[model samples]
Target: MLAALVLLLLTFALLLWPVAVTGGIASSLSYCLSALVPSLFPFMVLCGFAVESSAALWLSRPLGFCARYLFRLPDCCAAPVLMGLIGGYPAGARGTSLLLEKGRITEKEARRMLMFCVNPGLAFTVTYLGIGVFGSPALGLRLFLSVTLSAVVLGVLSGLFSPLPSPDKPGAERMESRPGALTRSVEGAARSVLLMCAFLLLFSGLSALLHEAGIFQGAVRLLSRLGVFTPNQWAAMLSFLLEVTGGTGDARALGIGPGFFAFGLAFGGVCVHLQVLAMFRKPPIRPPLFLLCRLAHGLLSAGAFALMGVISPMENASTAPVMAGIYRPELSGGWRGGASLALMCAAFLLMVPGETGKSSLRAPGPKLISVAGVKFPLQNR
Candidate 1:
C-alpha cells in the first residue's frame, strides 16, 4: 500500500515536472553517446565473445594456478573475473550468470565471485573519471589501481575463508564452440548495452524529478541541520549513492576529494547495482552480502586512493606523470597489444576449481546462449 502510494505520488511529480525529466534524460543520452557507449559497448562484445567462443577457457589457462592457490577456485572461474575487471558492471554479472547456467560454476561459487566481481571498467575509470573529471589521467590511473587492488584483496580474502567446493561437478568443462558465436555475442552485447542505457535514462529522469521537487534539497538541508555534512558535500554524497557518473562529476565540481570519487566508482551507485541484478533470473547473492561487500569495496578503494595521493600526489597536471600517454596509439603499440598484455597478467592472477579430472581436450556438449530472455542451444561444430 505504501509502495503504491509512493508510486502514485511519484507519477504526479513526474507529470508536474516533465521538462526537468526530459532535460535530465537528454543529458543522460548525451553522456551515453559520448562516454558510456564508447567505453562499454565494445568491451561488452569482446567479453561476451571470449566466453561464448571458448576463448575464455583457453585464455584463462595461464591463470589456472593462481585461481587454485589464491582464490581456491577452478581455472574456468578466472574467465569471469577477468571479464568483471575489464568489461565492468553487467559484463561480470552476465559472465557469472552464463557460467552458472552452464553449470561451469556452482551457485555458491557464483555468490562468492559476486563479492569482488561487477567492477567499473578501467576505461571508464581512467578515461572518463581520470581525464574527463579530474583533468589528470594519471590520477585516474591511480584510482583504477586502487579500485583493482581492493577487489583483488576481497577476492583473495573471500577465497581464503570460504570452503572450497567439490572439484568434479556434473556438466562442468563441457562447453562447446559453435558456429555464429561471434554473432550471438554481438547480439547479446547490443541488447545488454541497450538495457543499461535504458536504466541510465530512467534514473536520470527520476533524479531530475526529485531535484525539481526539492527532495534532494530537503535532504541536504536536513543533513546540514544535523551538521552531518556541508550542503555541497551532502549533495555530492547523495549523487554518489544514486548515480556514479553524475556523482563523480558532482564530486569534482563540489571540490570533493578524489577518494570520494574512487568510492563512487567502486560502489557503482544504485544504477549499476540494478543493472547487475537484472542480469540474473535469480540473484545469486543475498542483498545483505551484496551491500556489505559494496560498502567494503567503497571504503577500501577510498583508503587506497588516499594512500596513493599521499605517496605520489597527481593533482597537479604539470607534475603528474603522463600515464594517459600509454593509451595513445602513437605512443604505444596499440590498445590491442596493451589488452593482450593485461590479459596475460590477469590470467596469472586468477583461476577457479571445477571439472577436476576431466581431460581438457574432451569433446564438449552444446553451448547455450541467452539473448533477450530467450535461450537456445548451439550445436558444437
Candidate 2:
C-alpha cells in the first residue's frame, strides 16, 4: 500500500517536469544510438549466438577446469562466467537464464552463478575508461583486471557458502547444433537490447525528474554537511552511482581517482542493475542478494584498483603495453571487439575433446529433438 502510494505520488510529480523529463529521455536515446547500440548490440548478438549454437559448451572446456576445481561449480557454469567476464553486464545473466530455460541448470545454480557472473565488459572498462576518460590505456587494463579479480574472488567465496550438489555431472556430453541458431540468436539479441534501452531511458527520465525536484541536490547537501564528501564530490558520486554512462568521464574532475570509477564499473549503477533485472522474466536471485554482491564487488574493485595504483604508478605502467589493435579504444567498442572475443572462444574450442574421444556423461532433465543434423531441446509444456 505504501509502495503503491509512493509510486503514485512520484508519477504525479513526474508530470510536472515535462521539459526536464523530455530532455533526459532525448539524451538517453542519443547515448543509445551513439554508444549502447553500436557497442553492446553486436556483442549481445555474438553472445546469444554462442549459447544458442551450443558453441558455449565447446568453448567452456578450458574454463571448465577452473569452474569445477576452483569455483566448485558445475562445468556448465564456465560458459556464463566467460560471458560475464568478456561479453560484460547482462550477458552472463543472459547465458545463465538460457541454461535455466533449457532445463540444463536448476534455479538454485542459476541464482548462485549470477552472484559473480554479471560484470562490465573489457572493452568498456579498458577503452572508454582507460583511453577516453583517463587517456591511459594502462589504467583501464588495471581497472579491468581489478574488476575481474573481484568477480573471481566472489565466485570462489560463493562456492564456499553454497556448495554444489553431489553427482553434478556435466550438463551435456556433446554440442547440440541447430540450423536456426543464428536467426534465433539475432532475434533474442534484439529483444534483450530493446529491453536494456527501455530500462536505460526509464532510469534516465527518473533521474531527470529527481534532479528537477532537487532530490539529488538535497541528498548531496545532507551528506556534505556530515563531511562524507564535498558538495561537488557528493554530486558527482551520486550521478555516477545512479547512471554510470553520463558521469563516467574523468574522475579527477571531482578530485577523485580511478578507484571511484572502478567501483562504479563493478557496482554497475542502478540503471545497469535494472537493465540486468529486466533480462529475466522471473529473477532467480533476490534483490537483497543482488545488491549485496554488487556492493562487495564495488568495494573489492576499488581496493584492487588502489593496490594496483600503489604498486605500478601510471608513468611506469604505460611502458608495459597491452595488445596493439584489440584493446585500442576505437576498435574495442565495435565489430572487431566482438570478433576478437569470438575468435578467442573459438581458439579454446579446439581444446575440447571430440565425441569419439569423450566419455559419455549425461544429466536427466529435458527431452531432445533431432531434425536433419541439428538437435533442439523440446520446450516444457
Candidate 3:
C-alpha cells in the first residue's frame, strides 16, 4: 500500500511540475483530460460490464476443466486462468485473487496460474489491430494467430516446467463444490471487470497527461536513439511500454508496409509488459517467473513476426487506401469528447458497486466428493 501510494504521488508530482513552473496549468489540464476522456471512458464502461457478465462467465467452465485435466491445476484455478485469456490480464488477476481468498487455490497454484494468464484476446486482436489499426482483417488474423499460438505454446511449456503439487502432497486438499456457482461467477466477473476498468481509466489519464506535456515524445526520442530502432519503431516501443492502445496507434501511424507494422505490433510495446506486471500484484506471484514468461513470449513473438514479414505477400494497392481509411482517426468535434467522458463516468458507476451487497456464497454444503476415486472433505454453504 505504501509503495502504491508513493508511486501515485510521484506520478502526480511529475505531472504537476510543468504546470507549476510555467503557469500552464489550465492548458496542461485540458490537454490531459481531453486526450484521456475520449478513448478511456467508453472503453471502461462498455468493456467493463461486457467482460464480467458475458465473456468471463462464458469462458470459466471450459477453462476450469482444461486446467484441471490438462495442466493438473486445482479445480479452483481453472476459471481464473481462462478468464485471464478471455478477459485479459486484469480480469485474470482479479479472478485469481478471489479464488485465493476463498481458499479454493493455494498460493503456489495461484502463482503458476499468473504465469500464463496475462494476455489480450482474439476480439482485441480482430477489433483493435485488424480492423481499427491495420485496416485489413487479414493482417489482423495473421497477427492474432501468431500471438495466440505463441501464448499457447508458452503456456503449455510453462505448465510442464512448473508441475503442480500432487494430491498426496502434505498441503493438498480436496476441491469443494460451491452452491452458488452462477452467482459467484457473476460476482467474480463483475469485480474483475470493474477493477480493470479503473486501472484503464487511471492509466489512460496518466498517459494523456504525459502526452499533452510532450513527455511521451521526449521519451520516444530517447528510446529510439538507444538502439537499432528507427524513429517509428521507437514510438511503437514507447507506446507498448505505456499502453497497448497507444502502442498500436503508434504502429498504425508508422505508415510502413503491413509486414513491418505487423512485426512491430506482434513484438508488442512496453505497456503490455507493464499491464502484465500490474496483474501480478493480486496473486502475489514471483516477479521473476512472470518476467521470464514475458521475455519468452516477446522473443517468440518477434521471431514469428519477423518470419511473417519475410514471407507474407504484399497487400494489394487497392486495399492500401481502404486500410489507410480504416486506420485513420476521426477528429471529433469538442462535444463528442465530452459525451465520451459522460459515458465513461456512467459506466464506472454502474459496474463498480455490484459486488458490495452480495453475501459471500460458500461452496456446496460440506460433503465428501470423489476425485479419481478418492473421497475428500467438502466445504459447502
Best by TM-score: 1
C-alpha local distance difference test of each model: 0.75, 0.73, 0.52
Number of clashing residue pairs in every model? 7, 0, 11
- List pairs with backbone clashes in candidate 1: 63-347, 67-351, 73-352, 73-353, 74-352, 74-353, 75-352
lDDT of 2 by residue, 151-265 (tens): 9999888888666544334445244556888898788888988988888888788777766676866776677777766565566577677877754631344445666778888
Candidate order by decreasing TM-score? 1, 2, 3
Instruction: Give RMSD to native, each candidate.
Output: 19.2, 20.1, 18.8
lDDT of 2 at 196: 84
> Ten residues in a row with the worst lDDT in model 3?
372-381
TM-score of decoy 2? 0.77
Q: Candidate 2 at 239: error in angstroms?
A: 2.1
How many residue-pair clashes does candidate 1 contain?
Answer: 7
lDDT tens per residue, model 3, 215-270: 76677566655667665556555556555554454455444444444443443344
